[model samples]
Target: MRRGWICFTFFATLAAMTRFSIPSSAIAVNRSGSGGPVIVSIPHAGRIYPPEILAAARVGREQLERLEDSWCDLIAGQAADRGATVVQAVWARAVADCNRGEGQMAPGEVALPLRAQFSAPGRKERAGLGVIPTRLADCGSLWRFPIDRHGLNWRLESFHRPYHVALSRELARARARFGHAVLIDLHSMPAIPAGQPGHGARIVVGDRFGRTADDRITAAVVEEVERLGVSVTRNQPYAGGHIVSAHGRPDRSIHAVQIEIDRSLYLHPDRSPDHRAVVRMSEWFGGLIERLAGIAPGEDEVPLAAE
Candidate 1:
């Protein structure tokens, strides 16, 4: 409910001066400081949904609830204070996932889902992590019946569209002001998948195999967090998702990297609260962020300006 504000500064020969103004309210934009070449986006943290769609959900409230990134907002919510704008989604991922590409297909694709439903290619779709998930975690069947085409369209219009629109604007603003933009897509993942090898490293960074961002930028972020006593790995169980695919255009001077923090490091995967770890991790992230903010622009590895 708290809209972000933006600070702009023109560093000419004049002494320190900055412009503070209310950002566009069309979508929530939390402004922190003047042009800083960084934009932190949290697409999976939204929890709001339209009343009508919530009533029509095939899955029970509890099942839909558990799929959330869970406390992601609390982790990176203060990005605005560190000279970056944080564009957080307010709607629940169950309502519509902002990280998913538009028109992502589900299991019963040939059945022709309603216009509102999203259909797309990518692991999120194959893994049932679409705009409307086919399953909750590994559990079966979130929907009781096929969603009507008409109903599907409503979800897109209400939830999916607004979040992306807001993100696009912020990214554009960052690009305009700083001549480059680095979008840090922040998220959290469940530790140790069921029946699989445990994740040896706690923080996983995804740059789409170096296609989504400049290698040096990714290295800088990874190196900084690793210095804070956090084990860092690159592109393993989780690579970049839709947000990375859609916005990461290094050739265009916009670099995006997906940072997945293993939840076990901070929270009890058994769904219990671990306030101590959360606090420590949160503090560690704040330090890591400062390192990211300190990265200078115009590196030889920085991507060329986009067309």
Candidate 2:
């Protein structure tokens, strides 16, 4: 029963972040026991898929596997115990990428195409990595049969909408409890060529070119993690994805940062992750949360431990 349960050291300062109860299921969220300034989002770390959709996808059990969040959930799951609320997707990313805008539609795709003009099919979509992937990596098709409108709606209703409803609710609740909130949209990048630009930093901290969030919060997160001896970079490779574009608004005092961790750090190219290395990374993140939790929007609060 250790599917999603993990333990961590607790601190009084961490008690500031509050925990929220969600319906019990594979997708259940584990909110921080304390109220803190940070909210960690693990959008792509899902593995559950509807039976029908799985059957339609022509891929073998292992072949369809390439599209998983791998172990991103286990790493980010630690956030909930460290004064940061964690929101994760229970349905598989192949069902729908929570990081993507609502417009993503795959024709005969399992999910109903929303009634909106999405960004035209660009690199991410053509390569079968859009909000709703049409294919898998290496130019592989995911479906044995074409998807229809009704089936798409079924997935939308059963999977997509429910996920966002939970996510939006969590964000709203956090903002209400705390004067301000910060969302860390967590994801993992393939060690191989994902077609994302730049050499790909081990950890890419994105703030949407300084538009979505404040500079100070961004600086604190990036600097704290880098101090842990990990190679970190800025907006070059990942300048935040749909979650950032949707929820990040520093003006409203609800900030979001997209943290893209390189898969190679913890996983091999074959898609298997090293659990011990992942825990090491997670422990480092715990220390970072301890530091970020002390951050103050105004000049009054004390600087972080290192400062």
Candidate 3:
């Protein structure tokens, strides 16, 4: 497997640069030139589970696999020569969900002493989808053992912290060189529920109700998806998550949005990538990146120095 990261995979004049880290290798950072203004974040595509994580699980591979975004990585796998940066985590989300914040742990998920670090568990955390997933719908209590302080720190340092740190750094670098930046936090979703607004939609774009990005970004996303002959919706049921909240700073010319692709559109029943669908989605993203790279933010959205 590709262990090292900080790479650049190009489209027109493509070149990939890699930097190596630890724990199932590191993230893949593919740049083009100065890495344009767009950064693509694949937080949940991780498939590699260390022996420790698998051994600690009460559920089998199928239930553990539920934590993955499946093959979401391939959607943006080849946005070459387009100057968009892609930061992809290779470790499985079951190891440590990258989209969740550090404080999302439940009181019972961690050892008693470390419980104070987290506030009251939110709906997601309580439901066993927190930073370190503790339960699933039918599979109650996911771990064979509780999360002690060493276990908690190991995950944070090895998985969660590294993913976010790399993402933040790349976003900052893109913004610095391009005068502004946008993060496309990518993920895959199960079919939307029957009554949901985006139930029949093939793609859903989220910007946390206009807080994480300019309206223009969302508009551009919707337009691009429609151009590919796919139905799209916005902020329906699934808005952006902790990744958007933590990195999006439109106030400073850095924008972020979450894009959820319905798995049925591109995955097999077993959650593997459908090659044809993957290629179509890849080309869709490639063209969209080119188009978006050309869209300038508002004049008032100046790049301010950090305070």
Worst 10 residues of 1 by lDDT: 4-13
For residues 1-307, what per-residue lDDT tens digits would candidate 1 score against the true structure?
A: 1111110011110112212221232236677765466777777766665444455455577677787787777776456665678888766677667777767756463135343344444666667677666665566766544544434454555556777777678778877876777888889887645555336777889999899888877898788778767777788766788888888888888888999987777677675547887777667666655655555445543222221
RMSD of each: 11.7, 10.3, 9.4
State the displacement of the C-alpha of residue 86, model 2, in Å, after optimal TM-score superposition.
1.1
Total clashing pairs for each candidate: 20, 12, 16
Tens-digit lDDT track of model 3 for 170-287:
8888788777888999999988889877788878999999999999887888899899897888999778999999999999988999999989778899887899999988988887
| TM-score pick, better of 1 and 3 | 3
Report every candidate's CA lDDT. 0.66, 0.67, 0.80
Query: Which ranking of candidates, highest TM-score first?
Result: 3, 2, 1
Per-residue lDDT over 1-307 for candidate 2, one digit per residue giving the tens place of the 0 to 100 score: 2311111112111222322222234355677766566778787777777554565566766665577768887776467778887777777777667777656654333324432344366667666666666786574777653444444444455555666676677778877876677778888875425566546467888999888777888898789767867777788777898888888888887788888888877776666778888888888777777666666555444654422
**Candidate 3, after superposition: displacement of residue 161 in Å?**
0.9
- lDDT of candidate 2 vs native? 0.67
Model 2 misplaced stretches (Cα beyond 4 Å): 1-26, 106-119, 192-197, 298-307
| TM-scores of the candidates in the order shown | 0.79, 0.81, 0.87
lDDT over C-alpha atoms for residue 241 of model 3: 96
Q: Which runs of model 3 end up more than 4 angstroms from their true locations?
A: 1-24, 299-307
